[model samples]
Target: MKNFDIVTLTVNPSLDKSTSFRGLVPEQKIQCKNPRFDAGGGGINVSKAIARLGGESLCVFTSGGDTGKQLEALVQKEGIETHAIAVKNATRENLIALDLNTNSQYRFGFSGETLSEPEQQQILEAVSGLKTKYLVASGSLTQGMPPEFYQRIAAIAKASGIKFIADTSGEALQKTLETGVYLLKPNVGELAKLVGVEKIHADEADDAARTLIDKGQAEIVVVSLGPQGAVLVTKDITEFVPAPNVPKKSTVGAGDSMVGGMVWALSEGKPLQEVIRWGVACGSAATMNEGTQLFKADDARRLFEWLGRK
Candidate 1:
């Protein structure tokens, strides 16, 4: 509801190239039967998910080399507004593991080069132009960036009086929370880390979620519980929303799409609980598709209605 729409930032973006193989055999030269590569990284995926839901998100990210050009085209081809910061190094690529018979897959990501001093400044400059009320910064920070890089972003958004929605893990996530993130989407593993709990059982994850809010790290904490669904904890309300049973080709990108849907719904000023409901639906729908692609708006909408009934 401002001069500009949503803006997303990806410090260390990537181009994900995945291959479909018949089977994985260790210690031998194996050729994938089929392979495909697409624009990747959390921010990129978020923007794409937003677009799929008929919303626009300005995607600002760093890229370099031929891969950068390719990524730029890929992002733009989806009709997303893009602001690319050129870097000296090339972009990073990830390998995807797929099992043909079982139709299961695993993905391994490689960390790209760290942004140089000037490159970092360019990002700060971009930060100055955001007019949107919501700014979502997701994914891991590239190495060589100060450990508190995400913290600095959170501070910037907070200082500007903007809402910051963070989705990340490890030190970057922890550091950003200290800067006062508006909301956080953490899976079971991440929530466990935030609360210093070793194993997060389904029954106790809600209590742990409350502890995160109590710690003042995040105003809203949503602990995603895969098939069992997600538990949303706010300062005054905590609800467990069960995801409808959907046929999942793969679980990749389901969480990211959930975050995107939540942000989009909130951007429209929908009610809090409804936003959580939409998020749960989107996450489950993304699982219904194979590969890293997010859920289609139709599927997401259908799932939302289906879940709303109960």
Candidate 2:
């Protein structure tokens, strides 16, 4: 296997198909445009975002059936190197449709195929055998899979001295924290859940993130505040950067783009402040595109430059 500075894992991947229609009338036969297909999931989107930034990472995912084959083809089209593990069940598909009249986007997602016990073990074996500086595990666990799956991977990464970064929510995210990670990217709501709070206001974002860091759950906690921007918290550093206003588009891959930007920056030896800025820049830039498309390199660069002056 070839070596890479960053490695991303997507246990439950999807083939995302997007289209637009004139209006959303009840039970009407709405005429829709041709659908756009993209290989989507947390880790895969991260790899694609890294590629958009002129960087490379090994994308490891599960592949099965015709949908899986098509997903692999789409990832190849993006020019990302991948290591796909075959499975018995087909990969899931998701739909995203835009209502032109209301400018609203509706997303429909299906449950992923459950992984067999043996298949689950294969995933662990693959992660244990990898050689990389960063191991990023993202997305939701499939049906019937243990919530501690990511935590197990975190343990493997720890034993191998690989920096683990996780982007997930709910029980899976909670379990992974038990094993600890190098970094965690959680939205405001998810962060609130982690710290046992009902909500985390903007003024309390830093302390909320610090609660996790203080418990040794993570070395760095980056709380994404959406339009308000993001906050990066560590034991010694707490920097809050406001988001730059931009035109609205689809937000399908914004969070993954942020993770991709931060990991790429960390790999390049950038400072923590600049790393958070790059993350916010890429995330904001991702919303400038339609459907499941990530940010353009030019837009990200422009946003990064603008953010530097703030």
What is residue 52's positional error in candidate 1, in angstroms? 0.8
The runs of at least 3 residues in candidate 2 whose Cα sits more than 4 Å from the true structure, single-residue gaps closed, are none
lDDT of 1: 0.84
Candidate 1, residue 191: lDDT: 83
Candidate 2 C-alpha lDDT tens digits along 1-310: 6799999999999999999999888887999999999999999999998998889999999999999999999998989999999999999999999988888999999879999999999999999999999999989899899999999999999999999999988999999999999999998899989999999898898999898998999999999999999999999999888899999789999999999999999999999999999999999999999899889999999999999998
What total of clashing residue pairs does each candidate reach? 0, 0
Q: What lDDT does model 2 reach?
A: 0.94
For each candidate, the alpha-carbon lDDT, in order, equals 0.84, 0.94
lDDT of 1 by residue, 1-310 (tens): 2354677888888887776767677898877756566787888888888888888888889999999898899899989889899999998887776777678787888888978999998898888667778888877788888868888888888889888888888988888888778889998988888888788988888788888788887888888987899988887988889989888776777878898888888888888788889899888888887676678889999988888889
Candidate 1 residues lying further than 4 Å off, grouped into runs, are 1-3
